[model samples]
Target: MLYPPHQPLQAAAIPPQRGPAGPAREDESGPWHTEAVCRRDEAGLFFAPSKEPTAARLSREEAAKRVCARCPVVIECREHALLQPEPYGVWGGLTAAERRVVLARRRRREMELKKAASAPRIAAAG
Candidate 1:
């Protein structure tokens, strides 16, 4: 079943996705945390509940990203999500899988840069 029959239609509706709400908790006071545009949105949209179907989850994630696309602090949010290596849900306009692709590309670029940097030194030493 795409969704449990008992689940209300509203349950699948897209809501504004955000970070932890209310006054910045002591532990969440980092600059990115405070600056997040999602802070004012509902936190649930970004996360998939256990057992969510693949189709539903994809729809939900896209909805959450719509909010991210309009956010002012999207760059900070993306950086935080990438650095945290968040393993689930949608954050900063990208899903977990998309983040993986980006991370892989970034790693490849970093390795190439490192190799380039070392080549000059290696040649000098030889």
Candidate 2:
């Protein structure tokens, strides 16, 4: 379920991947990445191993999110995660499930805007 923005994130989190530091320096690839707080954190802290208990997964995700909360590049991190549609891990202080919800909302809003924009044109044409 969705929680209020001010409410501290709880439950259902994932681990982040290890990558080079400081705003993803662009190389041959055009995409740029922001510095992630999780980079300094231990990998095990973010993700649970296979067959882990539900409680353990929840705890690990919570720990990862705590780190994300303190991150300076949180917005950038979140944008990257959302764009990449990061399949796993808590990026930008949000769990994967949370991101999915966010994405769905975005899609719905976009569709509404598009439909609204076209309505006038359709009427004009008619």
Candidate 3:
């Protein structure tokens, strides 16, 4: 029996079959960062909303803080932001300035709580 010519090469030339593309479910084990699907301008800032043109015109620093208002992963983003202490851009939907403000407030609250916990209680006269 005559063997097929270049049978191995013919098999290699055939393309692998592929299934139709579909949306993937949210991955619980995967990284918590949001996907960068929004359109950005030349400065790497997200495109402004047409309805809120005034708000859209805000500086990159302010715009980032606004992102947290609507973001679903704000908590995770804030945790990552605190760990990394990123200098610029939006992380967990907060701007660099906003993060600094939040940290300061947190420290202030902690100090107040500590002071209250350590205060001596007055004894009632028998």
lDDT of 2 by residue, 95-115 (tens): 889999999999999999998
Least accurate stretch of 10 residues (summed lDDT) in model 3? 1-10
lDDT of each: 0.65, 0.64, 0.49
Candidate 2 stretches with Cα past 4 Å from truth are 1-34, 121-126
TM-score of 3: 0.51
Best TM-score goes to which candidate? 2
Best by lDDT: 1
Reference-based TM-score of each model: 0.66, 0.67, 0.51
lDDT tens digits by residue: candidate 3, 11-59:
3234322212222223764333323211121324532334446545467
Each prediction's RMSD to truth: 9.8, 10.3, 16.8
Candidate 2 lDDT for residue 36? 50
Clashing pairs in 3: none
Worst 10 residues of 1 by lDDT: 1-10
